[model samples]
Target: MTQTASMSQNGARGLVRGGALDVLRFVAALFIVLYHVAERAPVSLFALHPALSRGYLGTDFFLMLSGYVLARTYGERVLSGGVGTGEFLKRRMLRIWPAHLVMLVVFVAFVLGTAAIGLAPQNPQWFQWSQLLPQVFLVQAWFVPGISGWNMPTWTLSALIVCYAGFPAAWRLTAKVRSPWTTLAVGVAIFLAVDYAALAATGIPGHQLPLRFGLVRGIPLFVLGMLVARMPTTIPSRLADGLAIAAGLGVFALQALGRFDHASLALLSLLIYAAGASGAKGSAWASLAGRLSFSLFLTNQLVAVVWFGAQRAAAARFGFDATMLWLTWALALPACVAGAWLFERLVDTPLQAWIKRWSRREAAVPAPASEPIAA
Candidate 1:
């Protein structure tokens, strides 16, 4: 199949891929996977590492990255009328929803099959119609309570769909801001205000809230990301490296201190900008990881469910101690990476190409003629 055209219809093709951003995406995805498997690690080690516990903030990292890339790419196309908002939405939906729906179905089927064999699926919400309907429609993050229903990680996808739907208007509004710093400050303030309000109400860090609250969790960072993309400030490589290191340290400190709130979001924005500013220095490995990261993020939880279930079964059969859990930890990461790579090759890539082919065919069809009134 032909490559996806440039995000802007008029711009040159192939701006979407490569750079340090790819490396960052891969790392963020890996962090999230390890976060999910943290329970398998030794209690003392897990307790000591705040970064691993709060690693779910990796999703927030993804949201910021998404906002930056989408704004830099599609934002321009929509604003310039090079691509209609409807077309933009269609393309974005094509990029995300097919794979999401496929996995959603797979999860449901897996649950049912396990139930048939007399094993109760771990998450009961998967079978509830009330919860399943919203998730199937990709609005679970807006209304669901825990938001970890079905494939839990998809809360990000649901929130992202909302963001994509609003991108045209958001981009228009963002363009009106004359000063990039003001835009950046406003975005940061909105995030902090929301964080403060959540803290005051619940006495918990906002990022610790249910995944269903991902709508709130995602928006400010997303806005900040877009503003970062729009920023005129360009730090030299030496300074960018320093800032990146500092920001990385800041992220660790925030997580370590259990301040998993807007500070985490702010630090993530800085890290992404430091890595992505100017342009990405592309490499084969980084590009491969970037290509697989989405599939990895989307599929890992399902694989973990199966893997952990097997580990439990093994523990039951063999009477092993905590070592089995640690064994699962040793194996799970590579399994996830391999599984995600296969999913990308077998499912994600071909499904995307098929949709693109169908889209082209639909676009080629002539519109029906309007009827004239009889004289």
Candidate 2:
């Protein structure tokens, strides 16, 4: 039986529930939040701690994890036609779009409210009207010019949309390659080819592809993830644990040494595989954190905009000290976490539930009979 059938037989618990992957998801989300905060903080956190500069690797990890998770969950169904492509895309959109649209609206309101109060944003170019349409359609990352204004991180969403659209074909192609080693080889080759082409053309590595063309960066990492999912997990749990530890340490060591090379990517991939294979069923807290990871990621930018804007205004009014400024910047992290929890509970959950209900109703209703055309 396939994994999906097994899931159905076992109450739909999913393959990676309450696992190390969940903890990693939460950690990745937090690091991404920190990276953004470090970028915009007034005191320059990177100077004090250069490791914060490596937070962008969270995104790389996420792209790969997404591929792996989707492959494990849906690859068999997709390959066997148990889930049609259209239905799969619909499911993906439902998962991602609600939170994304909510964030987009919040950002729009933020920009308009700031304008109404005669307050100019620190970066006015990021709030341009020209970019709104692409953002609304979630196509901002598809070769669109100019910086991703509004919520900057939503560019990942745009890239992921393209990945989802192509996933059926990617799954089929990867499934055809029986040898996991050969699959890994193909994925690495694609990643290196894209990396080299990006370097040659734009002086940027594949992993650092600009927001306007994020699909270039997203696709290979996603494929790599799918390939990783195909690999056997026959090692002992203790061995998996050791490899995970080493890979995690390796990633940090490379970052500490200011090296962002293929070695780091290799370590990340190893870390993911080892963590998954360790069979560590995490606690409820870890599962909750995993559930909140998406919201944390989607809301961090908006939280930053509001949190820092208010901090700036307060500092200008009250003349904050260095200690006070740092305190407020530190506070933004938890504020982001709280905001994500609230958004997920209040907005995304309710909206998705309603969409699901409406979809069920639509499915229940019968279609009108077709009339015969005039001869």
**C-alpha positional error of residue 13 in candidate 2 after TM-score superposition, expressed in Å:** 12
Best by TM-score: 2
Q: List the residue pairs that clash in candidate 1.
A: 19-280
RMSD values, in order shown:
4.3, 3.8
Taking the tens digit of each residue's C-alpha lDDT, what string does model 1 give over 1-375? Answer: 111223333332233255667778999999898888787564634676656666757877888888887876666666777776676778888888899899889888988899899998655655665578787878888857643567778888888887888888888887898887888888877877887777788785455557777787777667778878776434565776677788989988877677555667778888887765523346678678898899998899889888878877887898877776677667989999998999999999999889889988987776667853211
Reference-based TM-score, model 1: 0.88
> Model 2: what TM-score?
0.92
Write down the lDDT of every candidate, Cα atoms only.
0.75, 0.83
**Alpha-carbon TM-score of each model against the true structure:** 0.88, 0.92
Give candidate 1 misplaced runs (Cα > 4 Å): 1-16, 42-46, 123-129, 145-147, 233-235, 253-261, 278-280, 321-324, 371-375
Residue-level lDDT tens digits of model 2 in 321-367:
98898889999999999999998889877888898899899877766
Model 1 per-residue lDDT at 7: 32
